[model samples]
Target: MKGGNMGNMMKQMQKMQKKMMAAQEELHEMSFESSAGGGMVTVVANGKKEITDVQIKEDVVDPDDVEMLQDLILTATNDVIKQIDDKTNETMGQFTQGMNMPGMF
Candidate 1:
């Protein structure tokens, strides 16, 4: 409650903010990959949960069973997204007591 204590608290908050920004930027620059169907389908995503790429093995592509192929792609995409989300939550949790969760702000 003292003035000096408040000033020090502000400085600490500023430092935490800077570190969080740096972590967010690093996360954004990183890449994540996941596959499904025994490597028949692969999906790549960035830390911001944006899909960067999707690859499918020719052998897995079945014209008659389009639904199966779709399932594989969906599985890969969802897995990669989960990876990004998990990493983000972990990195941000370092500065928070679980109150400032990822994507909340």
Candidate 2:
């Protein structure tokens, strides 16, 4: 490629990088929620896969069934994290599609 064309491509890549960063910031500000055990347990996670909140229905808590409760919580947490992962892939995949560059991230 000519020097001018290469420069233009670099500029475009930089612009896209900026946009991707902004989109990532937006994602970080967003939250994902998921529930398990028929809404008995719910968990919220940020785009970075950090748990933000957890909620358990009062009726779901049972001293005799602590294991069940734990399972529900785990399921909900995993689901919420998966949601964030999926959204991140969907959002960032747009910028990465058809690009063979490795180690750029």
TM-score of every prediction relative to native: 0.91, 0.92
Give the per-residue lDDT of model 1 (tens digit) for 1-105: 999999999999999999999999999999999999999999998888889898999999889999999999999998998888899878977878656455563
Q: What is the lDDT of candidate 2?
A: 0.90
Cand. 2 TM to true fold = 0.92
lDDT of 2 by residue, 28-73 (tens): 9998999999999999888888898899999999999999999999
Candidate 1 residue runs with Cα over 4 Å from true position: 98-105
Clashing pairs in 1: none
lDDT of 1: 0.91
Q: Rate the local accuracy (lDDT) of all candidates.
A: 0.91, 0.90
Error of 1 at 30 (Å): 0.9
Clash totals for all candidate models: 0, 0
State residue 76's C-alpha deviation in candidate 1, in Å. 0.3
Top lDDT hit: 1
